[model samples]
Target: MPKAKKKNRRKKYNYNVDRKKLNRAFRKRQAPRIKCSQIRHAWDRTKSVSQNLAEMGLAADPNKAVPIPKFMQPVMKMDIDGPEKKSKIVQKPYVLNELEYQASLPEKQSQTLSRDLIDYVQHMIQNHGENYKAMARDEKNYYQDTPKQIKSKINVYKRIYPEEYQAFCTSLQQEKMDKQ
Candidate 1:
């Protein structure tokens, strides 16, 4: 029997290899071409060193460029001649006498009792008679003063407005005198 003929398969085209070849061709064609005239006019090793330095502004004298004003320099320190003396700062103490201190403070004025307050106290004294403490606790009394406060306020009232208090004291003295 004759052998079957083998089939010849075509190879697949590779895109990467084709693309690289096209890029290489384009780069070579697009490369810049330098002219001989541009190179001749350009700075090269043929130019003198002094001419290159002058063109760079390095060859000019720095002193002749500009005069920096003398006033710009820092001021010198003043000459302090003799040996250094250490001077101390002294603070004075507050020395005030008792009278001077009292004079400096504000003065408190004694409060004067009103006629209505005097009358009220006289009425309470007449009704309660020596029982001021009970009158102080009574709700009917205008100022529900505590026993201690009531005593002090009565004493102050007697001193300030003494007419009623003096009359009460005189009557007591007269009763004692008559009994004697």
Candidate 2:
């Protein structure tokens, strides 16, 4: 029988020099042309664009170019030389009542555990009691979570459904009493 050819498993790092050169030439051709008038004398090659703009005295700060007035400017009304017209009648804005406002609001959604998750927690508690290590090792624990992770899941369940969790604990205690 003829011997099979050995496959090369090593990674090849071949740099395409021709492609790099072509890309560099293309980028140079596409470079933006800046006008002589656009170039400021106050501009520092080492400093950023904003710092250069601020140094030029063209703006106080590049970010806050437009200065905010300390007081609101009065609205100016101009009289036009045209035929006299009747004043426009203004209507009051429609206001919604409490009921209407409540109706307009979105309904609140309550987060509840899935049946499978609830059953999983119940099974873990029944099989392992408070021992998270035992729960983590349980065959029902398909996710193969650590003991800390198992404890955190149980804590989340307890926090989300405190009353239900309390009732569940009572039921477990009753089951133990019955067994005795």
The global C-alpha lDDT for each of the candidates, from Candidate 1 onward, is: 0.60, 0.71
Q: In model 2, which regions exceed 4 Å deviation?
A: 1-109
Residue-wise lDDT of candidate 1 within 12-61, one digit each (tens)? 78765888778988976764342433222332455564443344333345
Q: What is the lDDT of residue 85 in candidate 1?
A: 55
Show how many residue pairs clash in every candidate, following the order shown. Answer: 0, 0
Candidate 1: where is the Cα deviation over 4 Å?
Answer: 1-111, 171-180
What are the per-residue Cα lDDT tens digits for candidate 2 across 39-124?
Answer: 43333567776555444444436446565755665657466887787533222112123335556899774878888898999899
> What is the alpha-carbon lDDT of model 2 when measured against the actual structure?
0.71
**Prediction RMSDs, each to the true structure:** 37.7, 19.8
